[model samples]
Target: MFDLAEIIDIPPFSLDRQKKGELFTRALSDLTQYHQQNCHEYNQILQLLGGSKNSFSSIEDIPFIPVRLFKEYELLSVDQAEVIKTMTSSGTTGQSVSKIFLDKYTSTNQTKVLTKLVSSFTGKKRLPMLVIDTKAVLKDRNLFSARGAGILGFSMLGYDVTYALDERMELDWEQINAFIQKHKNEQILLFGFTFMIWEHFYKPLQSKGLQLPFENSILIHGGGWKKLIDEAVDNETYKKRIFEVTGIERIFNYYGMVEQTGSIFMECESGYLHSSIFSDVIIRDYKDFRSLGFGEQGLIQLVSLLPQSYPGHSILTEDIGELLGEDNCSCGRLGKYFKVHGRIKNAEIRGCSDTYAEGKK
Candidate 1:
């Protein structure tokens, strides 16, 4: 079995070059061997690609399965009865969702890792959380969707959580007003997907001159710029408009996917998506899958040492990104930092923060 403790025990973004490479490569090799021993499909793929624990030399040389393979296969290293939770990816109409089955150890450790990552940015205090989505998302305990999973996972950061939207996808201004009026003097955390916070909450209120008590709060958002791109709302414009309403300047956007749910890559104050100690990112060429240097755009391949129950540790994602630099970011955090350009051209439009997630939450 994969060693969950070894991977999760590392402090956030503190690994030097030698230690980071050593730990990451060792954990990747362990995950590959564990999955190959238990998952037949994964073993076949590794054998087909001539990959083995004895063959890996560096973190970059680790074998990566296409992320789409999850949608086509049940790639679990554990028994069906051992699955404690199943997380499904957001799928557009007619697209098949990827099912990620998690066992107890994997599930517990994943959420623990997520808490560590989030708390590292938002501090150890459990601030009151303001969720932009409706409360109906948590209605289902089984068959967890991406939006619901994200909400529940992030909810660990706070208590007395307030949902700002009603079930009909309309603003619950009365509740929001009451929530802010209650927590007006306290330091809080505002959590939401990117487009949801804008379309469902920010735009409606901004048009009416409505402002919340966010002067002392922090905004943590994830997902990408495609929807806002279509609406002509880029990051700076979105941040400026949000500041106009809330006076919030400590906004941090994260880059993550449902497959690698726990190892979220967050944008630091210096404006780069950083891989925490448990994860790493690599940019590869579209033509022959060669690794690219800094400032070159290519397919984004994400590696997470936290996937113990599923064969998702090393995944070649469909998103495009550029490796900015390693340990050179002004924020002073270690590991690789990069930029996600968004889904590859002609790729499927997915993720909850992208399109409000049709039929997802």
Candidate 2:
């Protein structure tokens, strides 16, 4: 079994493109055997792809498990006894989905992954992070949530700057003001989903004649911007508005999903989200699986080397992005980095109902 900590840590795996390719080759071989031993669905997928234990030589050559596989089966490459935590996607009413079967190794490793990504972007071992909810995570003992755990894990590491605001949601004015006011002399790091931060925090601050401490501050937001597409906030417009409010010259956005536990793509000062050596982002042509080149946007496919608890080492996702090559980013980081255009919301499939599925695929 691969020890999750050895390969990934706070700085995030930083091999050059050549070494990264080698790492993926090894992961491809190991994950193929692990999947055959534990997951049945991918076994069928492997057979279809003409893949075997020896067939995979590179990460790009490996077969990709669809993101929808979480809705189909347990899909873990580990024993049931080792299972620890299952993170879920927030489904609408009557529909909730979960990615099951995480062992202690997987859980702790997830914390490390998130920690590394967050720290790298902010350059703060403990940033005064402002979260949307302050108490919901600490109070909810009955429900074990992966998303919540992921956020709380990062927040706990830093200064506990999170607080409550509304009845169901938390927006602590004092804490927010205090963090901003104190951090005015330093770089501030703000974390949340894109829509949530824009709607709840940034928009309200604008109305109240407030702005973030610019310059050293960096905003890290995840989840798809599908909701904001119809709301008419283009990336430039959104960034400009945020700049006006926060006065922060640097803004960073990330692209990631729960399935690939190892790495995250972070936007640098150059304004391109760069992939770590531990993962590969494929800009697919439409829904077709074959890889697409730069300047073209299509379905985003992720080939990750970071799944020990499950067979998500290589998975395809519904997001879209364009590839910025090794020479593109002004920041010195290597490997592929792409900007997300938006999520494919119209890709929702109907009539196919599953208990684990929170929404239409």
Candidate 3:
């Protein structure tokens, strides 16, 4: 059986390649059979794919379904009455959105794992938080989009949380200035979507000839890199410009999707996204879905131990990435470290930042 508590109790990046493989192969194999027995639709899909319920020798031997399946079908292993929340993927006006149902057990575990992973970077102390978006995004308590979920997940790490923008999505100078003055001598935390921080926060602050003294603080942003890419902005340029505007030298960008909300791949100081002990990433050949070795760019497949209410334990994402190495990063973190190269060529532009940009226009 897969003991989530055992995995959660372990340090996020403490396991090396061999240890992580052994742990994940057992847990994921058990989870596969559990889902097969509980979810009829999932079982049918596995039966069609000829997936056996027996133990998997390696992590790569486990069958994975396309991530898009969530958008098309309601895949859940728990009963509907047990669901406490429903998380939706970010999308533009008429696009389909994925609905992920979460029961109490899955919801609580997600929060716990997220806290552990994020605290590995930002210490366990909760700091004053400055969110780059408006509070309006979190108005809906029952149904949360990826943007809202991200904010809520990170909000638990901060105290005296304040929004940097108003309900209209405009920069709230008064609110921001107050937050800065109150926490001037302390190291604070800032959170936001990548494009929102760039478009709504950085650009506006720069154009107005304003600068903030946030050198003592850290900023964590992710998602919507696709929109920034369209504007010809790369990661280095984004980091440089953000530092120029906010003076926050410590900025970490994470990579995650709504399907696996808690188990995020956080970028290390060496600028590589790392897989933690609770989750792992595998690059696959775009043509044959064969697992690719390190340094080869291909589709990204993600596996996590966080989803029990749903069969999202293993999913083949549409994003492109390359496995840089295992247990050998300069940052000294164990497990796999890799880099995401954006979405597949023809994949839809459906990140949180891109959706917000389109809706505003």
On TM-score, the candidate that comes out on top is: 3
**Candidate 3: Cα lDDT at 187:** 94
Q: Estimate each model's TM-score.
A: 0.96, 0.85, 0.98
Which tens-of-lDDT digit does each residue in 144-199 have in candidate 2? Answer: 45446546655654675655345444467776677667666865556666666676
Off by over 4 Å in 3: none
- The global C-alpha lDDT for each of the candidates, from Candidate 1 onward, is 0.87, 0.65, 0.92
How much is 154 displaced in model 1, in angstroms? 0.4
What is the alpha-carbon lDDT of model 2 when measured against the actual structure? 0.65
User: How does model 3 fare in lDDT?
Assistant: 0.92
On the 0 to 100 scale, the lDDT of residue 13 in model 2 is: 34
Instruction: Residues 190-227, candidate 1: write the lDDT tens digits.
Output: 89889888888898888899877688889998865687
For model 3, what is the error of residue 273's alpha carbon versus the real structure, in angstroms, after optimal superposition?
Answer: 0.3
All candidates in order of lDDT, best leading: 3, 1, 2
Candidate numbers sorted by TM-score from highest down: 3, 1, 2
**Cα lDDT for residue 213, candidate 3:** 86
Query: Where does candidate 2 clash, by residue pair?
Result: 164-171, 165-170, 165-171, 212-246, 214-247
